[model samples]
Target: MIETIVFDVGETLTRDDCYWNLWADWLGIPRHTLSALVGAVVAQGLDNAEALRLVRPGIDLAAEYHAREAAGRGECLDESDLYDDVHPGLSALQQLGVRVVIAGNQTGRVGELLRGLDLPADVIVTSAEWGVAKPQPEFFHRVLEVAQAAPDETLYVGDHPANDIFPAKAAGLRAAHIRRGPWGHLWADAPEVVAAADWRIDSLTQLVDVVRA
Candidate 1:
């Protein structure tokens, strides 16, 4: 039985494509250029912080990204973007006796986002705060520890196969892929990437059934 569910924030739970669009707008560059820039940074093999520093000079990339989102939408970037029925879904999960946690590369803002939405998860595991990135067994193991869940009893859902599915499966958790529209298209040619997931769903609402089953 699945006693716990862990979710990835960006792309998976949140509207990351919208966020990326805001970033592109703020940078006054084409969206694909920004995408390519990220690809270039990764191609050079820089760590997250180093890659951000090298590519987005003179800026805290995460902060700037949030600022752009807030400005463009005229609202604070809250965790509501993570799910449409944020409170309802969480309440339903809690009522069903399932513990929910969030595991992601948060760069320090996810806690604030969750707080703003008033959706305090059972636990939060972040790469920026944890000093480890997903796809690494250590990161998922940390979340498993905090959730007090046996790997087999937990389910991990995320959009990125490499960052989400692969490590979660390797760590012994069941994995699910949440396909985030345009952003998911970026991996269209890579079927092998998502092969690690035990199941795949297009929306967060669909997770309820997967967990209940």
Candidate 2:
């Protein structure tokens, strides 16, 4: 049985459409360009620093993208408007007596978002604070330590296969891939990603069954 459920922040708990479109508009770049650039960065296996460098030349990189949702323009982005589905799912999980945590590559902004949303989490493990990003063994290990959960006792739900599923499995956690439309294609041709995950789900609601089973 799963005692703890850890979630990825971006696509898993929140809909990021507004954020991306805002960035694309602010940079005067086509939305597709931004999307393609992100795809390229992921495909190239660029680290966060390298990814930031590549985008900085053309866009504000972080600030402009985050300012739209965050309360203070220059300050960190707040996620007060979490996706409609996420809050209910979380509440359900809590009602079921499962501990919940968030494990993602948030750059300190997610914490602010959580506070803004009034969503209190048991623990938060972010790459910025941990000094390591997902798909890295150390990242998952750090989260596991904070959650006080063995890999087998915890369930990691995330959208990115490489960043979420791959590393979680490597660190001994049960991994689930939350395939959200076009983004799912990233893993379609990669057998390793599919093999890494113990389950594949298209929606957060599906997690209830996965956990119950």
Candidate 3:
């Protein structure tokens, strides 16, 4: 039985529309343009930051991010940014004694933002906090360490296959490919995702039955 459930942030737990829209406003670009580039990079399996580079060649993203913060425009989130099913799904799991963890590749400010939401998760952390990003073995290693459960008994759920499914499987954790968001729905039936994911689900609510079964 799955004793612990670890979730990915973008698309899996929270919709990233606001997050990226803020970026669009920050970079003075059309939202659709950046959104399109994001899709293009994901389709090509390029790092997500590549999308920004594609838009503004030679742009220093880290510096720009700090500048945006200094301008009082940085990463932000709220209940509205979350999917409708996040609370129902996680709360049900918590009631069932399943440990729920929210970890993802997000800025440290996002870590604070998520904590502010007060989601029903035992632990909420981010890549920025750990200084390691997803698709890195050490990241999953730390996930397993925090889970306090055997890798096989812990499930890592996310929308990105290369970053979430493949890496979680490689780390011996069961992986669930969530079919929402651009990455999720687009890659839902991709050969590699279909082959690698231990489970492919469309709704966070479905996780209840997943844990029970």
| Candidate with the greatest TM-score versus the true structure | 3
**140-177 per-residue lDDT for model 2 (tens digits):** 88878877777798999887776788778888889888
What ranges in model 2 sit over 4 Å off?
39-81
**lDDT tens digits, residues 84-182, model 3?**
999999999999999999999999999999999989999999999999999999999999988999999999999998899999999999999999888
**Candidate 1 deviant stretches above 4 angstroms:** 30-76, 181-194
TM-score winner, 1 or 2: 2
Of the two candidates 1 and 3, the one with more favorable lDDT, higher being better, is: 3
Candidate structures ordered by TM-score, highest first: 3, 2, 1
Full-model lDDT, candidate 2: 0.71
The whole-model lDDT of each prediction reads 0.69, 0.71, 0.93
Evaluation by lDDT, superior candidate among 1 and 2: 2
RMSD of each: 4.9, 3.8, 0.9
TM-score for candidate 3, residues paired by index? 0.97
| TM-score, cand. 2 vs. native | 0.78
Residue pairs with clashing backbones, model 1 = none
Clashes of 1: 0
Worst 10 residues of 2 by lDDT: 72-81
